[model samples]
Target chain A: ADVAAAQAASARQDSLTKPPRALGRLEELAIFMAGWQGTPRPVIDRAQALVFAGNHGVCAQGVNPFPQEVTAQMVANFDAGGAAINQLCRASGADLSVIALDLDRPTADITEAPAMSADEVLDAIRRGAGAVDADAQVLVLGEMGIGNSTIAAALAHAVFGGAAADWVGRGTGVDDEGLTRKADVVARAVERHAGIRGAALLAALGGREQAAICGAVLQARALSIPVILDGFICTAATAPLFDADPRLLDHCLVGHASREPGHTRLLHEMGKAPILALDMALGEGSGAAVALGVLRAALECHNGMATFAEAGVAGG
Target chain B: ADVAAAQAASARQDSLTKPPRALGRLEELAIFMAGWQGTPRPVIDRAQALVFAGNHGVCAQGVNPFPQEVTAQMVANFDAGGAAINQLCRASGADLSVIALDLDRPTADITEAPAMSADEVLDAIRRGAGAVDADAQVLVLGEMGIGNSTIAAALAHAVFGGAAADWVGRGTGVDDEGLTRKADVVARAVERHAGIRGAALLAALGGREQAAICGAVLQARALSIPVILDGFICTAATAPLFDADPRLLDHCLVGHASREPGHTRLLHEMGKAPILALDMALGEGSGAAVALGVLRAALECHNGMATFAEAGVAGG
Candidate 1:
């Protein structure tokens, strides 16, 4: 009855009010709701970007200039409190946790994150859930890895079921030939995992970082915590997340639309709307971190604003 | 030397062999420059809500329940300047301006806005340009006129080129019969002005307030001032402004994607990107005015954020 009434009211509203003007007002209302709903309060514990660092075997194909060693080294840098992502996390009041998993070699005290096995992914999820404070939500996610995009694209294709070319993109600025090779490699991986589906797809082609992100996202929702989705590659890795559990979307917010074409398609497929669209393609959860500021402002407006009725003004 | 070096360095940046992080950091530099260029002192000039008040001749066809006299009375209320929009403006650090352009009755200093003749609109453009200070900008544009949406839809059809049903939406809760009449009225208006195009279509079917807005927008751009476009009706009315000049787009930051289907089409035609999407159908430029708060914040962030280099962080 309520839904029917609301629908009827909306139809009546269409009949009564002017559409353009009303729609403009509604957009403001949605922003208000998003900002209000996902507002972050200062808790005793800090938020963190759980960067699950990993490597793809496909990088051996010379898809990127960086060696697999850089992934582990960067993990060490993050653990040693160096690196741009760490600095951004520091600036945004987020704790930096570097988890090295799926690498041929690993770093110390950075948590021996297992490879993208189902059990390892599940353990990562449990760990992320445990790490987050009861009073605060976690913004756990992945970081840079050589050929991570290929792994992510393969995972997305297996779960989302589109052509690899449609899902795969030029990760880390590939040349035309490299892009074709990257797409082919991802397609082969997707084809290899045709039998295993859903969360298993995360296990197959997803980087350790991506598997950790999938775990974090699932766990965050179970704990009633909110998550901010970053760029294309990270989002691709987490594609199996929605296929495994649709409810995870309720606890997530898209931070920004990337300049990459795939990111927009992913956002549309997930039925998510981004908060900002300044053509962001950076993937350190940088856009999401910036959006956290806007989210804070939105909450302030909703919680603090005096509505028309409260302010003794005519609303209509 | 610093400026030259910066430009020269920027020219050579693409060729630089750097990590992926370098590209991510440079875009912010462009944003910072753009924001800093917009304002030097970054003082918040209390904004003004200028509501153009007028009436459409089509209202005489029994297209609305409210008598055309209401337009003049609303103008008087605005002249006394105690309308809801006026009150909200005053409360939100916004001054209110009531330009009684097409009121049935003459108003004293309600600002003699003649019938939306081309000369009048051009003069209005000059007047709108004159309203802003050298350092400050007006952040809102609104209107209040009886049966104005008829003019709005006709303008949308003329500019956007679609069926009347596609563009002509319910203006003010008209019933099925009323909607038919409203569509018929708009279709006739569109047919009547087949030869007329752009601003001329607006002048023929548009209300006095709309012409003033068209003028205001043009002037705003000439003076490098920005205007917050309101919802469906206001957008429909302003459609011709874009057709008249494309440079005007730089000055228009769409506040919301209005619910009216026509509004979305109009926004697309104008090449203005909306900042919010709430399905709001309210007018009076309230949505646009509210969105300015966020735009201001974006400007602040762009201009004021400390870069990695400045913050003594590693760029790569």
Candidate 2:
């Protein structure tokens, strides 16, 4: 009751803009900013996606039909500039940076693939986030691990302390029976890491890419940068990060509502509003890249709008 | 059970895209285009707002301190392109068209305000909607009016056949006592027009602009051009139209879930989603105009976009 009263009072207090009631819309937006780290108005000096490319161990399950090699192939596709997420990011003015976080048994072709321990992944993320100029903000905390959803689900279960069977879902649209098997696999993974919490959960169940994203989200929040959270996989991994420190939610903006039912439920749990509901299940932060334009437009509208009082019109 | 089954089947039938499971992110956009007049993938070549500008008869109750003149001034503000809605529409590439429907008394000095009766409003709406190209769409809606909430409550009571007290709210932040007075006035208005259905309710209490908007929404639906709905005033008029003919739901897209509490329950009654939860209370079709951009992006993404198969990428 005390918290509710405080929130209500805050909601009313934030409505006080310069010249009283003028710029009501912008005033409301400023109130929304109170929940984030950025100065009430976030200027996107730079929008970047750190694609944590990796092949997951859970692909051994029949949960996903795609071959594990596609993870590296897609990484090469991103590097060669052919992936759809790459194209969309380019179109939307996002710089794509790839980190070869993990491929437990590396194939012969890509020998340069960086083998990162959980701590190394964290260090790399902090380093990448540090590379951004102080004035500019990193907008996307994105992941690109093949079969990472299983890893994400397990990590999320441990982080938020949810049941593995309840939190686990049909990643890449497995059948009802396949879903049961996937749940069992995730439950075993979660049980194996039951005592672990926070960053440890990432090391146990989190993919290299997922751990890197956790680092980026944490670093971005520390720097007051806005992190655009993509669909289920990204949210699943980051849920624990937020649970570890609720302040992390301050720097995040929900990119889009994923078609996966768990995604919207998780977003609601986190008190986020997905700017778009475009049913984007294709990962690699495709939805986040697209959502940037909408947020940009929203900010533009919030800033550029001529208030009713400014227009010398009487209020209704 | 029967209605749920039918809706489920309708939902399934709406998912038939050209290439099965190819354009994953883009396929969900089909729901927005499912009931358009043109081909399934309708081009939103031009979008227009049919703003129903009027003043409620019940404003005489002193619920709002602003004289009814603000309605006409705001309408002129919209015409002279000074209102927030105007700025937003200009930002979003929408044509602003205004109609002066059934204002009880216009403030002097506003030039050439069209005084439309219920009949004229219906005719103008049909004609205005028809003027747009077949591929284009229109959102028929209302903006500000003194004591508009009272009028809406009366209209809702008449159409949804609920008690007027159920729908009345704090229009423009009336005090608790003022709200009681406002509700009483609407209840009286509802009694005066008791059992009056559809057009007669408009003739009795609905403001000119709201009547025009209602007419436009129904005509647009009949003509098969999609109509995106806004807040309470527009929605109150909608009940009568949908009550008159249930088929109008086909062409409708609810833009924002209004800040007015009545709207959520109404939307649920109509079974709508993809609601842009903007918490918007200001009308003038601003919310719908913003939603139009979202819908346009969805349509464009749907119609344009190489399928995973087309792009020769392995499905994730």
Candidate 3:
């Protein structure tokens, strides 16, 4: 991060027409952007939103309510501009793309074995990283997979050293019986993959979409493009990176606390506060896309509003 | 409010490509807008934002940090498109207007006498109501006044039966001493005006800007335009109306929960949850303007997303 630029932005915030710190987190958001963009006044002219979709083998355990084909169908819907993320990205001025991560192939069910081979995980990550636009100022990451929430729960439990039930949640409107089965699947998967850690743990319990999110986040950081992470699935997908190094997420913000119970717990474990908490649990970069509006508003006020001296307004 | 339209919108939400309630409060927001707009698909093509500025005699008690002239100066800044609200409104696509409510004449010190007589309060309300745009789809309300936070605190304490210390806060960055003196002033004012209720209570402790907010909110309801209220001062201004009729704020949304200590308590008292809580305390309709972006996103998804059958996606 550009510390000097962040300091400059903070100094400018004190000079704004409003009272000092009156904009609260907005002031922090603008300064954070300034640091990442290496300028006291940062603007997001190109925001790239990427949604990675893959079918999960965990569906064999009946953890998800939706069919595996729904993942590919949602990608088509995204292309047709008929999904929530599409509307949100359009409203927030983000250019969005959906990448289907070998949807015709499903990872091995985690309950039986590792979700993917190390090489397969690496390839998925490379695809995610390659999809990021070099010219984009910021990246928004989300995911689509039928049983990815189960994958997310297993990954989170393994990385955070928590009970499987603590990380499991009803994804996509699962019933009470489905919820119990989902928890059991998570427990069995974590136990089967015991002692696996870091990237190996991810390969053992994560989905292709999850691995891709990790790649996209890392790629954005490498290009000095700040990232906005979507809900539970997206966050859990990056948990292994955070496990390796907490500072890996310094350039990212969790967009919203999802209604999925595990998301808030996961966010708490990561020591990150989401920008929005409107109970939104939908993935596909929708939460991050909606939060892009707030980031835009922050930067607009930072760069557009007159200083107290310029406005001839007395400061307290 | 059109119940049929709201019901239709809710039903449409269930049919969207995503799982049920995956959009969470965004779904509720769209349905609420539908009810107010009397359409299953609501759109906010024209949003009007108003900032009311007034001078406060409460400043006489040394309760404020800035000079009373600052209110008028900020109004000038707003008119010149150089203030925070101007930038926020521009970013959120809202038409911005500033009304200086007789800033040349400060209201009587609430600790000494009622802030305004019945006639003066009524005139201010009329002016506030007259400022609303009939064709606007939504109204955003905010305020500007030196010591108006004290006015808000006093009004809240009187209406909610709270201790003066509970309502008083360091508005616009007052010091520990200023805060103590402000709380004392509130106690004295509320004690002197004990037993006043409803609109009379507003006149007893509220500034012209506060009363104007009540009028504007009522005017929006009359025109069937949904309202988004700014921070503490705006909410406190409309508290008396809420006290008069709990249903008075049925068309309104608290845009954000302000960092001001009283604001959260007041919101809890009113049983209203703000759409955003970014720790914002700048009450120039800035918070409300930012929240308008979320409302816009909600409606966009509600009106634009393809249904399950349309997307050929399986529903849970």
Candidate 4:
């Protein structure tokens, strides 16, 4: 972070007419962006939402009501500008693209063995990262995958060392029976990979899209491009990144808190708070897309608002 | 409330690809608006933020650091497009207007007696309601007055029967002594105006700007135009209306929960939850101005999003 830019933002904030901190976290977000952009004023001229669509092997265990084909269907829906994320992008003036990663090549069910080999996870991450436009000022990470929440819960349980049931939730319309089956799948995954950790743990329990998100976040930070994180499956992918480098979150904003039980724990682990808390459970970066308006509005205030001296108002 | 329109919105929601209530309260808001607008796709075409500037009598109590002069100065800032709310309106494509209501004449010190004559309060409300253009599609209620939170606290305390301290909070910036003084002021006002309720309570404790906001909200509802409520002072002004007609709130959306303690109790009283909780406290309808973007975006999604059949995606 650029301390000089952040300090400058604080100084400018002090000159606003309202009492210091009246803007609350909105002020903090602006200051953080100012520092990250190395300017007292920062703007988001172009934004993109990258949807990583994949399929999970855990669906074989009847974890979710939807068939694996739903992932491919949602990807097509996104391409046709008919998905939730599509309308959100149109509303926020952000571009939307679907990354159709492998869908038929489901990995070994987490309850039985390691989900994916390390090479595969790393390769998927790199592919995910390469798909992003380096010129885009900001990115919103989203995912569309059938039964991916199952992988998310399993991964979180392994890394966070929680009871599997505590981390699992009824994702995408899972009934009580389906919920129990998902929890059982996660519990067995934890037992199957009891001692794994770090990158190894990621490869052991993560799904294709989850690995891609982890990879893309790492790439975005390396490129100094900010990313907005969506709901649970996407957030769970960050567990390994948090383990690798906590500061990686400096380049990200939590769009909204997901209703998924694991997402709340995952956010707690990241030590980040969401900008919106609408209990939004639908993925495809819908929450982050809605938040794009808020973030852009923050930048507008940061750049367009006048200081007390300029406004001829009393300083805070 | 238009039950037929609401039913249509619900039917349309069921046809969307997401599961029932997957978007949380956001979906509900769109549905409500669709019903109220008598269209499946209700949109806010023209929005306005009405900032009612006035002087508070309780400023004499040293309840805040800023003097009453700041209210007029901020109104000038609003006219110059220099305030936070001005930037917010510009970002959201909403019009901003500054109403220079009588400010030199502060209300009677509420700790001792009534703030304004019943006629003056009612006239202020009428004046406020008239300021809103009939052509405006939506209104965002805001206020500009130092120590107005004291008036808000007093009004809420008298109407809601809470302890004075529960309703009192730092308005602009208050020291520990000032906070205690503000709370003491509220306590005294609550005791002084014991059993005063409804329109009578408003005249007894409300500031000029507070009364106007109340009037504007009521007028908006009468015109079938929706309002987005800002922070405590503006929101507290509506307590009597809530007591009189709970249906009036069907036309309002609580933009964000203010940092003030009473705003929570006030929203709880209104039986509504804020769309955003940014902890924003500086009012010029700033929170509501920001919410205009979300509201517009919601309309965009409702209008542009394709249903499951249209998108050729599987139903929920």
- Interface Cα RMSD for all candidates? 8.0, 5.4, 0.6, 1.3
**Per-prediction DockQ scores?**
0.17, 0.23, 0.90, 0.75
Model 2 residue A181 CA deviation (Å) reads 2.0
Candidate closest to the true structure, highest TM-score: 3
Cα lDDT tens digits, model 2, B1-316, are 1234334433442332211332243443344454453344445667776676766545656666567777776776677765656655665567777776545563211111222355655664555454444445655354567667666666676676665567777666777898787777767666665666756555566565555566576567666667777777677767767666666666777766767667776777667663466566667776676666666655554544443444445652
In candidate 1, what are the lDDT values of residues A1-316, reduced to their tens digit? 1234334333332332222234433323223333322432212143556666667666665666566666665555556554445544544456656666657742111112212556766665565455554445447354667667667666667777778788766666677898888777767666666677667765566566776677777666665556677777777767777887766666677766767667778888888887666555656565665455444433333233333333333323
Candidate 2: which pairs clash? B52-B209, B101-B208, B102-B208
- Arrange candidates by DockQ, descending: 3, 4, 2, 1
Q: Give the range of the ten consecutive residues with the poorest summed lDDT in model 1 chain A.
A: A106-115
| Model 4 misplaced regions, further than 4 Å | none
Q: Candidate 1 local accuracy as lDDT?
A: 0.58
TM-score per candidate: 0.69, 0.80, 0.99, 0.97
Candidate 2 TM-score versus the reference: 0.80
Candidates 1 and 3 compared: the better one by TM-score is 3
Clashing residue pairs in all predictions, respectively, total 22, 3, 0, 0
lDDT of model 1 at position B290: 49
The parts of candidate 3 lying over 4 Å away from their true place are: none
**Is 1 or 3 the stronger prediction by lDDT?**
3
Per-model lDDT = 0.58, 0.60, 0.92, 0.82
Worst 10 residues of 1 chain B by lDDT: B106-115
